[model samples]
Target: MESDLPIRKIIHVDMDAYYASVAQLDDPSLVGKPIAVGGGGTRGVISAASYEARTFGVRSAMSGALAKKLCPELIFVRTNFERYQELSEKIRAIFFEYTDLVEPLSLDEAYLDVTVNKKGNPSASMIAAEIREKIKARTGLNASAGISINKFIAKVASDINKPNGQKTVAPEDVLPFLETLDIKKFYGVGKVMKEKMYRHGIYTGADLKKKSVAFLQEHFGKSGAYYYDIVRGIHHSQVKPERTRKSLAAERTFSENISSEIFMLERLENIALEVERRLKKSKVAGRTITLKIKYRDFTLQTRSKTLPLYISSKELIMENVKDLLYQDEMRDSVRLLGISMSNLNNENPKKTKDISEKIIDVQLKLDF
Candidate 1:
């Protein structure tokens, strides 16, 4: 009764030294050299470091002063978030080609459920290999993958072969494989948790697995139940793609105060362009448009319009954005202008709309 959960096929895909790798990919001379991104000034921290820099004690979030002392010749560059985001989107699109059940951990790591995939391939390893290849082909970057019976093993496997490698754990090997896992490597067991585990003589997967769920809960509260289940390779969580996107809009602070209506229209034009660019890149469109304006005194006002159809076109977007801007009350010298869109069309209009309420309640249900 305890072993009835279906044999799951999960893959964890992680980019190797993601930020540093992207920098290296763009510059051939940087390859095989120690490089760090961020930390240009005296009081800055390193965002990421290449494998070469890591050998010299450089690490993410390390102070620039400390990192420089560790590696005299460490190369540092500013973080290019826009480029990083673009590459992330490109890589994510490749993953979608194989499976929609991708759960992105960050820009660099994600867990994928390949038990059921678009390619219909029974082999998760094959799908992983294809994804890795596509990423390299499209973006000129290397990525590592791990495949296993569940998310836990797959995540652990992905890091076993670092830089550019993969590992797989079959269902039958789960227990023995986890038996040898170090206490520190167990998910959710951090530095403090490690000390507690050591105190309890829980040094390995086998030690932790031996503790009753009730006993562990008594000792560790809510997390105890989690560790107990994972030690025995039990994780019932689904691959959730329920990611919520926050802040779908952007605004700007003007360099100068401008009063001309024509100038305001022109500023709104540029803002609209950026909004449309973001919408298309994210594969999203909105039914509403909003206009915000600020006067020289810093007082602000806004007006909005909701359309009957979802819009992504640049020209039409600006038209509605302009309308909203005009509708706003204007009294003083306008210093800043902004445009935004929301009220998304959750369903694609190209597809058939949902059945009418009467049809859904009567014909469809009754017919079935």
Candidate 2:
């Protein structure tokens, strides 16, 4: 239940590589080594990788065959989703110790409306720090946190530091930070809107601030108002514990999970471009991008990257995704390709107010 309070404090917490990291932590030898949780042949796809495997280009969603090509020594493991769910529930229980206003996005991420809490902590930052420490100690996993006056800033803050990291965004710094952020990184901005922003000279958040409410409304239609409010750091939406998610997606099964270098790149580029287009239309920014791959042997792998920034650019999206992909050692020929982005932008829409003076010297005759 929400507190009948003037201010609502929200914090976003995300575990780093929840599944893969967990597997690695359970097995110490896997540390500092490239390892995937899935992918063995034409029907298999990677589920996750150790940080070491990430460096070698093995990633979730790449054809097992392709992952093998990138990393010959890549090891594959199966996903124990049930175990992950158990851990997720354990973490959720910990969150409940502080506030009942907890909203889970997935097993690894959640938002906590801590405006009023059972623990009665006055400082959100303090609570965030304590939470991080508690999660680490309890789960043996690193979690990042964002603390702010609102959800958008809080989510963004969480990313500034990652892998057992935390950050706070005060009210005074919110607008400026949004202004300087990339257009694609804004909560409501994406590739197509970005193209429009580019044409309108709105590359950075600063540039976006230059747009007038009327102009933004004209281009973005109803969302322009949303853009307007966020730029000013105002959001009427509450930390909805039961808010219905606007979108849901699933994997695209391929005709064959064969791994051919040229074929995979072409498929990847197409998949990315398509997802990029969809994100633009909704004016949504997602914090997580999950890649799914299926190989010939009917094996599967899933890898995901949660961004500190809500992003909607083909380049930024693809860059992290590509990193996740190339982490695998080529084990067999790949036949499928897939991509998805979530954690949509949570920052307020920005509007740059130009303080530049319009000089009109009506009384200049006094100088004469």
Candidate 3:
């Protein structure tokens, strides 16, 4: 049976250790050495790690202390957001030269839909190569890309060849490629989920394919359906041009845990101020204010209150946050505090495609 779904060419371009790479590019002395961007202080968390540092198991989100233990000589560099934003714009400009269907996931990576591009390039793989070359020429940074028929496969393939490399999973190879993929390699399947899938006897995509949708849903809930479809190369998500901002937030991880309400209030004030500044800069207000608390033991808790009217000022945001904070007694010493605003006034409608409408079996012609 033939399906009516369109066979689109999607490319996922991800920079190689964006923050750490930028630091190395700016400083000649740091190249070829173990370097980590961010995670400077006692309680600091790593934002990015260079390939050199990664050799010693140093990774982003690892604590500064632990990273130091992993690689004693690892150089720690502070994050410079302004510099990162500047380079990100340069890369995105190059992406626009080929197609306007660019979706930036972060300052480091984005998804580009070039099924019908301005360059009239028939092969997405060729466009990806050109873009990587242009980025190297313009910014002196290496980028990796994954080209496939859908975003999920494209995203996963991008990591296959890392640090100045690219991979393209032609339409004909999608099913076989996924069948042999390790369950851990599936995008969105993290450590916890991987362990859960292991217990279910799903160690690979082929194992996942054997399970019935009803069995998957009964065990894994909503995400089970997603896993069932994706394992068979059946993702229908489109490459959105404009991803809406669902919420705005700011957070701080304290060097030392605090148990006193007075100290908590002090920390909340700073967080609220940052959130307000961000909200005002974006010209948006929110009716829901959520207080995120992370305890010393790493347990997380959230308290939220939604008002009838939208609020963007620091004073109003702090007012509701204080109420939520006092609404419950301290469970343990707090290690991190965050303020997030949701139900924003600037929410925009998103473009969506229904994967359930039909199954696509067209042979894609993406060449590598």
Candidate 2 global TM-score: 0.62
| TM-scores of the candidates in the order shown | 0.68, 0.62, 0.89
Task: Count residue pairs with overlapping backbones in model 3.
Answer: 0
- Whole-model lDDT, candidate 1? 0.80
lDDT for each residue of candidate 2 in 1-368, tens digit (9 for 90 to 100): 11222445678998887888888778888776777887765657777776677787777778788888889888787777768887898888889898777778888989887666678676777888888888889988888998876677677677778767888776556777777778777755766888887887778877777889899999889988777767666764556554444432334445565577667766777787777876875567677888777676757677887877777777887787787787686567665567877665634445333211111211111100
In order of lDDT, best first, we have 3, 1, 2
Candidate 1 vs candidate 3: the lDDT winner is 3
Residues 256-330 of candidate 3: C-alpha lDDT, one tens digit per residue: 999999999999999999899889977889999999999999999999999999999999998999999999998
User: How many residue pairs clash in all the candidates, one count each?
Assistant: 0, 64, 0
lDDT of 1 by residue, 76-194 (tens): 98778798999999999998887777789889889887776688687888888898989999999899998887788788889889888888777777888888999888767889999
Cα error, residue 307 of model 3, in Å, equals 2.4
Give the range where candidate 2 is weakest over 10 consecutive residues by summed lDDT.
359-368
**lDDT (Cα, 0-100) at 35 in candidate 3:** 97
- Tell me the alpha-carbon RMSD of every candidate: 10.4, 16.2, 3.5
Model 2 per-residue lDDT at 69? 87
Q: On TM-score, who's better, 2 or 3?
A: 3
Highest TM-score scorer:
3
Question: Model 2 lDDT vs. the true structure?
Answer: 0.72
